[model samples]
Target: MKRIFLAGLLIFALNVNAQVQTPAASPHAELEQVVGLTEVKVDYSRPNMRGREIFGDLVPYGAIWRTGANATTKFMIDKPVMISGKELKPGTYSLYTVPGEDMWEVVFYTDDSNPLITEFEEEKVALRTMVEPMEMPMNMETFTIVIDDVMADSAVLNILWANTVVPVKFNVMTDAEVMKSIDLALAGPSAGDYYNAAVYYLNSGKDIEKAKMWMNKAMDMTEKPGFWQYRQQSLILAKAGDKKAAIEAAKKSLEGAKAYGNADYIKMNTDSLKEWGAM
Candidate 1:
């Protein structure tokens, strides 16, 4: 009985020692956002301050950092984006930055085989830009990165750590996408399609005759055309320098707008008619 008890005690001690857990110093993090139609993703590791001086002592100023604690920080973009007015192609890149008192050098390297950036070859750099660092109001114990101030075509990529914030502005091309969609929509033209094409042509100053043809088709296809469509027709005619037809279309738009009880469109048509000498 004594021998068995001693063996059981030895086994429990060995098990407890083997089960010791030491968590990672830096934890992995991921951020993904959509700016316009482009998808931007970032993968990195976050390291805490742990009550030590971070900037000048641990991270070091004026030196390249992996932008994370462990492994190379991966930045993946689905489509082309403009950063600080410079264009970057769509792909995965390794993000690195050189910390500074005022300005920081941001780098996107195509090759990121080295996590420490110790073998950073200039040839592997895809894009490089400089940005100013902003002082944070409060100390940030853990490193953080976020996509902020998102607009229709632009957003800011922010990095916050140790009371410092660095922001990089990026823009996505929306016009090209809108134009492509317009082309596809106009391929099999419906009444609404014709109206949209006419509006685009009229506004862009491209072929007034085509705009007139499309407006005519839109009106003919709709058994009861809306006042807005007639409004577009009037605008198209006016741009085509057909004052007489523009005035006639404006009158039709005014009548239709009144019938729909749309005060705004009624005012629009009334103003347009007065301008065209049809009131």
Candidate 2:
């Protein structure tokens, strides 16, 4: 009887293994974007139109859609972000959508296990916002999501499908991070640290004298100063109204870059020297 039972189990396993399977009609897709100090990621499936109606007919109005083909669409943010002027904490969320004639409701659900919008619980919603849908001039064959119009602290999350587009605006806080990094860097001044501070001061229109001081400190700290660092020193000197010193630094930078076989830096120094009447 034990042998018969083992034989039945083997047959069942064999039948399960012999079952036919194929790839999903919609393929999986993933994308990541870095906005300032924040990292945002999205994972979803892309479904093609295939000459069928998407929004109104196949997907019907006023009904919640999975926003993708198979599995729940995932949205992940490493840091807190403000969406539509509202703050959202850092975490992963399931994305869903409710289609309408002129507008759509975008939902960010804390629960990620629900594959169908019908199964999603309203109590698990993290954020729900209504956005106007823009009609596109041409139909998009496959559903697409992109991070667009990126700036230092802001970006647009664009969703395009069929002939419609929806855009969600978000912002990241980078100023606090920049200030914290500057504080840490000032605590322990390395050669690179001094050089970066000098460059930042030069570009941001801070005190030119302070920029020159930091650049000199960077040059003094390094045993073998790089061509790029010397080039930056030259710029700082020029900004400080010391043309003679700038010309001398440019010459040194050009020679160092030639020794390092860095063609780009050599060209950069050469152009600056010519522009400053060093040649």
Please report the candidate that would top TM-score against the real structure.
Answer: 1
lDDT by residue for model 1 (27-130), tens: 99999998888899999999998998988889899888988887878889999999878899999999999888889989999986745655568788889999
Cand. 1 Cα-lDDT: 0.88
The true-versus-predicted C-alpha distance at residue 118 of model 1, in Å, is 3.7
The TM-score between candidate 2 and the true structure equals 0.60
Candidate 2: segments with Cα more than 4 A from true spot: 1-21, 119-122, 187-279
| Per-residue error (Å), model 2, residue 237 | 46
For each candidate, what TM-score against the reference? 0.60, 0.60
lDDT by residue (tens digit), candidate 2, 1-279: 999999999999999899688977899999999999899999999999999999998878888887888877899999888887777788999888888998998888898885675755778888888889999999999999999998989998888999999898889988778888999778788878888899999999999999999999999999988778889999999989999999999999999999989999899999999999877
